[model samples]
Target: MFTTFRGGSSGAWRVISMSPVTGETLPAVPSLSVTHAAAIALPLLPSSNAWRLAGVASHVRYVERNEKVALVAVQAGLGRPEASHAALIPIRKNAAWWDLTQNERRRIFEDKSRHIADSLKYLPAIARQLYHCRDLGEPFDFLTWFEFAPEHAAAFEELVAQLRGTEEWSYVEREADLRLVRERV
Candidate 1:
């Protein structure tokens, strides 16, 4: 299924805050809503809408069979009742990153950066979903959604900080961190 995230005045998620980590920032919006469909017609967004992004929940990439098994063993599902705090971080990497062959990228992602190993410790606590939009010609290459209990917010921060400090992040050209809270019905 394709997932679409809308940032505007309406959504089940209230925007806590949004900040630019690098490059241009997305226009501010009061809330965010997510929807899933077999196919998404994105141009339908109202003219007044601040922004919208869509991507597919594709298979896990950059991991070996053992790593994939390990991830599935420990990674938790999204929307757990007690996990309300969330963040939608959209990132666009520079051409240099895209230029690299898949193998080269994988080496940097894990062997050099240790992205997966470092993140495993925080799993089951911080649920996350990664969406790929580059194929759709979206502004961002990837949209990462993360969820956790309010108390685990600090750990989430640490994860983000650690990832950003990696050599892989040097290829990122644009990134925006949008913090959110699940709106009570």
Candidate 2:
């Protein structure tokens, strides 16, 4: 069983131990939200690619709740240019995004929603930072849909780098696959 300790403003962390079943008190591992669980587990899996992609999708969805940035999406691709293109969309809006077809939207949702749902486990904490992650229903892409307060970009960047750099780094390519979208709402 999992025991969660509320850390007040710091949120809750879980303490996991098998000893509970054996009527003993063993040291528990640091409690991790579902996102972190997936992040840490992704790289260790035999199918790292699939897991990493799902991890990225999960991370993206976690960060999408920011109110200042409207939407963000990241996609892995066959070439550096493809990654580049995916990265560039949030920096500048594409007319195509606003013109997406229903099929395209459905494809994006089907592919990305599970990660988003997993990400939602941390929504309360993420919401405290004024951000949320989502999938734009576009293929195997992970989307971060959020908004940033004025002058918060630098801080946001730092926070993102630090968060993504943790055990989840493998799930998200810091330099390539994480996309940011910021807009004043």
Candidate 3:
């Protein structure tokens, strides 16, 4: 399956395509445009494969750690000014993620809350530092954290260009609500 999430102030849409084998969703590829085709029809084509390779490359270069609160931090680069950082906090009972009984989901949510509270005394600090680092536009802006990596930013931009060239892109929409906080210390 394929799922596309599109959102912005002007407008937004999402398209989902499904895979027969696993019944899983994958990112949808969009249709290419004429102008884009004219730009890349020449010698610049070969280098495109590099991105595919990069995608398969080991994420080991990235340091990953999970906290009891179901938050995962992926820190890459070593003291480099351009270092990339991303933190994923999976709140239990993500309504958009899956379908489950309310009671069961509530239990999971409570468990996650408890785990988060019990994991570390400094968790509040960590959360504050990360979430409050910058103001991205909306709650869904959290997704932009993954794009902060220089490499990822470039690659994704290229990927979007390529997809636009093929005329395979579609649109979909969703609502995401989140809170932001900063650490005082």
Give the lDDT of residue 11 in candidate 1. 86
Write candidate 3's Cα lDDT for 104-182 as tens digits: 4444433433323332332222222112111222222112112123344444334323422331111112312211111
What is the descending lDDT order? 1, 2, 3
Instruction: Note the clash tally of each candidate.
Output: 0, 24, 26
User: Which model, 1 or 2, shows the larger lDDT?
Assistant: 1
Backbone clash total, candidate 3: 26
Candidate 3, after superposition: displacement of residue 87 in Å? 2.9
Query: Superposing all C-alpha atoms, what RMSD in Å does each candidate have to the true structure?
Result: 1.2, 18.3, 17.8
Better of 1 and 3 by lDDT: 1
Number of the predicted model whose lDDT against the real structure is largest: 1
- Which parts of model 3 have CA positions greater than 4 angstroms off? 1-97, 128-185
Report the number of the highest-TM-score candidate: 1
Q: How far is 136's C-alpha from truth in model 1 (Å)?
A: 0.4
